[model samples]
Target chain A: MYGLIGKMRAARGQRDAVMDVLRETTGALPGCLSYVIAIDPVDADAIWVTEVWTDQASHKASLQLPEVQAAIAKARPFIAGFEFQVETRPVGGFGLPTAEPG
Target chain B: MYGLIGKMRAARGQRDAVMDVLRETTGALPGCLSYVIAIDPVDADAIWVTEVWTDQASHKASLQLPEVQAAIAKARPFIAGFEFQVETRPVGGFGLPTAEPG
Candidate 1:
């Protein structure tokens, strides 16, 4: 499955606000297996987003969903910067969907 | 729940070996809600492990499990370095268990 893990910064003193915006992304994002928003205990302004999807296209397509687009717009102001980003392929573990053989 | 997100580098030509070690960690970790091993698409030596547990104590206790201890020892040689580590509290998301009210 396609995976994305990234570190992001919230506007100064706005980490909680940014988290709220992300938490609202419970819209119908088909193929999205996991979309976790977590607070970084070490950095007040840092937040981590970890995502897993059935495929790359499913992930890309979710970006255009009206709800997702709206979330991006709403969260723009609170986003300060991104520290790092990486694309990944999930191997296996608990709480993840079983990957289908290609 | 307690959460941990970290980036790890595998020794040269041993990423898959390192992943195998981690993936074999499917032992009975009581409170481990999620433990995913993902490969970094951009870096051959980089891997990301995202984990969530019911509580801090559960996570801490897991380190002492025989299987986990064994895996750590087996993978130590192939483990090059840890790029970063962070503690977190998950707010909400899919593929995660609901947080119980305290």
Candidate 2:
């Protein structure tokens, strides 16, 4: 599976709002195994997003989806800038969404 | 829920070995909702661990479990050192472990 770990910084006092947009727009996407938005404890404005997908194509496809595009548009104003984006491969672990029967 | 995103550096040429131990020792942890091991794409020797738990106490308590302790011991030699550790609160997400029957 494909994985992405990225850090995003929100504008001052806008972290909650940014997360709200994320919550609204995320989920229900096919091929998404895991997608978590977390608050960075020390840096009040920083949020880390962890994502797991069945493959790279699936993740790329999600970005082109209307909901995700709307999320980016809605969240852009409150975002300061991204810190980093790292991609990886997930071999195995817990809490991954189970595969549905074909 | 409690979330942790950490970067661990492995000894030269030992990334797979380190991840191997992690895969063997990470699952079925009580209170652990997710524990994913991913390789940092840009850094050949670095790995990122993303974890979620039901609560802080449960996470802390797991450190004392024999399996966890054994994992630390078993993987230590191949570890270079931790780069960073960030704690986060997960307000909502996908692929988090569903609550078990009470």
Candidate 3:
């Protein structure tokens, strides 16, 4: 599976607002296995997003969706900056129900 | 539950080597729900690690374990640098089987 691990820094205390948009925006994409948004315990202004998709193409396609675009537009104002964006190939784990068949 | 999302840059083409160490090191710590390591698709020298634990204390305590400390020491040589480390409070999601009671 394809995975994305990244962090977004929100403006001042706007982290929750941005997280709301992210949670609302990430509707059921075709290949989405998991989409989790969490508040940074140490950095109050940071939000960490972890996503698991069936493949890289699915993740790319989701970005072009209208909802995603709208969400980006909505959250853009609160975003201070992005940090540590990395792509990954997920193997397997406890809560990963979408384990692809080999 | 507590979560950690971060990226580690490996030295030159040592990403895979570093990943191996990570996988080997993260062996069933108490309260550790998940520990996944993935390579950065775009960056050849980067690795992304996503971890979910029962609580912040568990994660902190794990770090002090002999095995964990040994793993860190073993992996340190290949680590180029760290980027985008964030602590998170996970709500709920698929594949995240360790969802705590509300």
lDDT of 3 by residue, A9-74 (tens): 999989888877876666567788777777777778888778888899999999999888998999
TM-score for chain B considered on its own, for each of the candidates: 0.92, 0.93, 0.92
**lDDT score for residue A24 of model 3:** 69
Candidate 2, residue A39: Cα displacement in angstroms equals 1.2
> Candidate 1 has which clashing residue pairs, if any?
none
Task: Evaluate model 2: give its lDDT.
Answer: 0.85
Query: Could you tell me the TM-score of candidate 1?
Result: 0.90
The segments of candidate 3 whose C-alpha lies over 4 angstroms from its true place after superposition are A9-29, A42-45, A61-85, A91-95, A98-102, B100-102
Flag regions of model 2 displaced more than 4 Å: A98-102, B98-102
**Model 3 quality (TM-score):** 0.70
TM-score of each predicted structure versus truth:
0.90, 0.91, 0.70
Q: True interface contacts reproduced by each model, as a fraction? A: 0.75, 0.70, 0.45
Scoring only chain A, what TM-score does candidate 1 earn?
0.92
Which 10 consecutive positions of candidate 2 chain A have the poorest summed lDDT? Answer: A93-102
Candidate 3: RMSD over Cα atoms? 4.1
Model 2 Cα lDDT, one tens digit per residue, A1-102: 889989999999999999889888777698998888888778899988888999999999999999889989999999999998889877677777652211
Candidate 1 stretches greater than 4 Å from native: A99-102, B99-102
Estimate, for each residue in B5-74, the C-alpha lDDT of model 3 and write its tens digit.
7778999888877877776776668888767767766778877778888899999999999998998999
